[model samples]
Target: MKYWNLKKINQSAFEKTGIVPRSMSKLFNRFKQELNPNAEVEALEEFKVAKYQTSTSIKYIIVLLITPILINQLSKISVLDPLVNHLWNKNSNYIFLNPSQEERAFADLQRFEEKLHFEILIGKLDALSAENVNNKMSNKALAIALEYSQESVNAIKNIIADFISIIIFVSIIITNKRQFSILKSFINELIYGLSDTAKAFLIILFTDIFVGFHSPHGWEIVIEAILRHFGLPESRDFIFIFISTFPVILDTIFKYWIFRYLNKISPSAVATYHNMNE
Candidate 1:
């Protein structure tokens, strides 16, 4: 608080000192580069796959999405959910499995590296979460640091949502040709962006109005209504999720089909990534 209140930026003094931290300045320059649609890393990282999923391929696109939403719904989940809080704690005070948390995270990520699609998503989320924690866990008070209005926290949340949307949209493109894995970190990402007000509101709304901790799970009631309307049994939660996936799946297909066709028709004008990594 003292530093935040006291540290004033003077335009002339800044010009004289030119004292931007190398690490902070790099991000600004990187963001400027990202304004280019053809930024080198973005192009390299995005690969177009012809065969996305198949009968023989893997099932499950990360069951972990539900976990964060639930963990996030809990009051003061900061103190309640250790793995998640530990995973999400915006500080570096904690260690994992005898190694630095980030190192442990990378090692944990190695298990899925063989699946190229899984590898990429894991890399993105783990790095995102760990970085979010590592940067703010020290010095700042947890309450203020976690405030939704706080820039650093908001940045991580926005990035997580953006990442999930990208993963979903991209997964749609590779439909039925291959199988990919999604990890827990994807959901953990959104927790960063919520404002203290937003989180408090959500905690109240989801608990009291929507889910009602004393009553049946909100998902159950919604599922029951839809299932009964369709003359299906209410017991089959999997059926509901399977059905829900169709829209997102098809939208992805249509989007990527458009992109692929465009690239095929006008490779020079539209294509930037080589479509295969070196």
Candidate 2:
């Protein structure tokens, strides 16, 4: 009677939580004696261990190959150049030899439309705000996007120039270990990435800043030379100089600043603590 009562209590407890009692194995054996018997379970422990081992080995090999290339690539950013030397196959694809990329009056405009939708976005953002605060954000973001596009353009064009500069800088470092040590960290920080509008803005802004003015469509080089040689300043009393220089400088500056600005705006942590201080 006591055994039967204990069995009933155990059954009631198991029913409540759906956990089998220790003695349930005996019940299964009894059933198996009367019925058929075949139990099967496949285990995957060995295969899983082998797969994890192979993955770790492959990751180590990849790191060994990539680390040096990444380190070398990080080392050059500034110093001005004559601009003509930065070429891909002496042109950007078909641009240099056949014709020119920026030769068309509205090349940047049309290209931006196709890939970036930049102008349309700016228009929408501007329409969203009545408050001065909201309006400022719209205008600022619009300007930055425009600038980013331009900077990205200049960065690509100047790729050769940057490469040449890197080679020279690296050579200098290799020859003098002491000098190299002074700038190791700086070299690592020198690689620049610019978005399209930002690139355009920097190219425009710098030309304006350096020579002091802006020209999007682009005056002929001969025409610009004639003006600068004859004494034309951007702000006062000079006709051609202001027209020639301002546009390029402003365009360059806008492009670079906007590119950097937008990069910081995204979720990724920026490189320097100075960005935080600002």
Candidate 3:
């Protein structure tokens, strides 16, 4: 039997369409376990399982939080930063991932030029020829180049650090298989054990954030941020396509899970969700 199916018997009373004989058998078994003389032993075993789940969960969280930051700092101190900068700086086009970055660079230079003009207008500086303006713009362009190079190097560091973190994350989950199973079961129980009203509220909240009408706008912003973080081109077409298709697919899968699993496991919660949604 599946490990998560262990709670099936306990929730048999909540089943709206079960055979009488099977229901009686489940009741008898529940009564036997509750009235058993080894109740203390059972309680102690459950406590041990919960302890393992807690420790494993904490380890997971710590690894996720610490590993990437540690790796990033170490890379900056090591040869990683110099090597990436050398390779990246060799290509002039690599300085900016997309035209938006170039536009922002020019905008900053324009602002600096405007400030210089304002200073001259207030008689705070001597009048400048066109050559002086060109020279200042050239210096600003060089500064922008150095800044973009640093950004690209940081993006490379982020990619390496995140990849290593994920490897460690998977290794931990694999090594602590039993504890992972316990944690998974514990989370499932916690969610499914919520009161019907609480369940309905959570369902609405999650759906609104992830699959609601406004979610596409949020998704667009997130996609743009992720692309910019990795020094990738921010393509509007790609963002729009993903926002259109991915959320629809996610919504469909969510509905399928509710119908196939949640409906069978807790029909009352499903009913509550429907009523609240309407």
Candidate 4:
């Protein structure tokens, strides 16, 4: 009596209908298995680490394009302008002259006093009232204070822009890392395991699913849901801040899970792939 071969029978079916049917069956099986926490964890551990190792030159280019926009938007915050102006006013000095002519006269006297006492006086004069000494100090102090205020405002704006840029840069990195992980998993199961002809056919299907789900527009809904959950205000600054920083938070959590759990099951594979180049 001849024994039947199950593997041969499956190969025959795969040959007859092509890899599409087999791939579809495998896809569904994987999907079902992924529904289980244990199976999902195991699958993540087995995920192809090599596929994700590549240059991030394109990612850096993307960051360069995006960081400027984030900085520009952050610089436009209304609060910054008012804070700068208010600080400028508070830190600046101004003489309170009663009449317009007296103000002009005080200005002339200030110039004369500065020219005459250039070598003698070491400090500025405060509150140059008509009855007070014409010590040219008020004008010098006002000029110095105004200069300092301008410098301080510019410094603050630069600091804030730099901070926002850093946040945006980190967010972009995290987003790219997550995308690489997804691509690796898809390639491992769908492309690496298939014949060349099967890979060609399935690549179209995979590309459609990957592009559709990974579009930035899809993130808007998730961002909105999170904002509503936290009862955050819907102001422009709040919205922009969320748009800039939320991806970093979300991707960090995802990477944390993969490293924390997946690393335990496949220690060697995980260790070798980390800090991968480009």
Who wins the TM-score comparison? 3
Rank ordering of all candidates by TM-score, starting from the highest? 3, 4, 1, 2
Model 1 agreement with the true structure over 131-169: per-residue lDDT tens digits: 554454332334332332232232334444445545655
Model 2 spans with C-alpha error above 4 angstroms? 1-52, 61-69, 78-98, 104-278
Off by over 4 Å in 1: 1-190, 213-223, 233-278
How high is each candidate's TM-score?
Answer: 0.18, 0.18, 0.75, 0.28
Q: Which scores higher on lDDT, 1 or 2?
A: 2
Put down candidate 4 lDDT per residue, 70-90, tens digits, no spaces: 675667475566775676568
lDDT, each prediction? 0.38, 0.40, 0.73, 0.49
Candidate 2 whole-model C-alpha lDDT, 0 to 1: 0.40
- How do the residues 39-115 of candidate 2 rate in per-residue lDDT, one tens digit apiece? 22111332343343345335543443454344434432332323333532354333321122233214544454443
Candidate order by lDDT, decreasing, is 3, 4, 2, 1
Residue-wise lDDT of candidate 3 within 142-237, one digit each (tens)? 998878767767777677766776776677678866546555655665676687789889988988899999999899889988987777777889
Which runs in model 4 stand beyond 4 Å of their true positions?
Answer: 1-59, 65-79, 87-137, 178-278
Candidate 3: clashing pairs of residues: none
